[model samples]
Target: MSALARNRVGQYEVASDLSFGDLSAAVAAGWRDFRAAPLYGLFFAAIFAAAGIGLSYYFYNRGELAWLIAAAAGFPLLAPFAAAGLYEVSRRRLSGDSIGWGPVLGAVKAGDGQLPVMGVIAFVIFAFWVILAHTVFGVFLGQSGLGATPLQTLLTPAGLGMLGVGSAIGGIVALFLFAITVVSLPMLIDREVDFITAIIVSVRVVQLNTFLMLSWAVIIALLAFAAMAPAFVGLLVVLPLLGHATFHLYRRAVR
Candidate 1:
């Protein structure tokens, strides 16, 4: 394959060959980045964890804990935004620049208005996911589970069908979101490009490395869910680790 172009249009060349070794290295580098800037990682991770905890608390108190399944599935949809700061930290570390709160936070503004645009896109997708999830829940469980415990509700035949259908839909939605933003968010942080161009490049990267990138998406989802199982504390470590790792992955996947 020809080398990726570094042209004038702010487009990046996608790497044609990305192996599992590259993924491991990116994760290792992410760990190093986190170690190098534990405070920054911890700070961002704390905010993410707090939000998860807050949502869980809010629903659990209202006797609607079951709805958390949908929220949890959709929650990571917003991760690219939470990762905005972590990407900044990794970028600065790689460039040998000073790592400070001001500069790291300021990196969100580095995209020249594209970051917020991406943020809006992410929020809209999340909103859609939530609404769809609610509809699915209603269609399957409806008032049948009104007085039942969350666990009891999920044990019903209707609940099982809903789970099956909902998982299939959520998986497709998450994969689509992943392909578009996987490289785009970091690309925006690294360069100055409109959201449209960045998304195109990102989707191209995933298309070129479909199996490998899908494996990456699975790893991220699994790790994130496992982290959330521990009262959101694991996110203090997992989110930063994954966030930093993603930036490094973007570095390897894009030129």
Candidate 2:
């Protein structure tokens, strides 16, 4: 099949004759495309970080654990915005458009209308995971007739064992969830794909490139840690670079 006739799904070029070498080339192309717009990326990152800090401060000042709860609850509400910049980067790169703040904002704004729907979907998914996690914890740890408080029971060997098991289970579940969703939102935005398809594709990508994706995940976590440590000021730089890099990665995986 001609390259022009290739079916594009998210970033993947769906042609039967495509080779791993071609895929690698696509990934390299994506990285090169992303690097072309470093300043634009920095600008988006500044906006995202500022908004995140403002929201975080608002939650902290309220002192209503409910606000923190709600903020956690509303995390998916903000997922679309996070995906917006990445989508903008990918779209522009694919179209061979010059990157700039104006076009990026325009593209994101055009797509902003979908955020609510995506947010709702994200909220439901997040809620389900939270419920499942808590249920698992309660079943495995709470049922252990250790004591009144899990912490108090931790003074004993059995309690420690239970705690370790619970922690390990929780960690595994969290990692699984992260792997499923890491590329999903951006894929949705970049390709105008539905949420479910995007998520499934993302999960497939993670399954296909587990070690590489895990390395990327670790890098993201470390960058996030550094950004959050300094009153989140570092996020202005880190968030955008990561956002752009994520788009680059998404492009690499699909095509």
Assess candidate 2 and give its TM-score to the true structure: 0.60
**What digit string (tens of lDDT, one per residue) describes model 2 on residues 155-232?**
676556645764465456546656656666666566666666666677777766667676666666666657756766
Each prediction's TM-score versus the true structure: 0.93, 0.60
Clashes within 3 Å, all models in order:
0, 5
Candidate 1: count the clashes: 0
Question: Which residue runs of candidate 1 sit more than 4 Å off their true CA positions?
Answer: 1-10
Summing lDDT over every window of 10 consecutive residues in candidate 1, give the lowest-scoring window.
1-10
Residue 27 Cα positional deviation in candidate 2, in Å, after optimal superposition: 10
Per residue, candidate 1 scores C-alpha lDDT tens digits across 95-168 of 99888899888877867889888888888988899889878988887767535466776777887888898999
lDDT of 1 at 129: 92
Write down the TM-score for model 1.
0.93
Per-residue lDDT of 67 in model 2: 38
Q: Stretches of candidate 2 above 4 Å error?
A: 1-39, 62-83, 100-103, 106-116, 123-177
lDDT, residue 177, candidate 1: 92
| Highest-lDDT candidate | 1
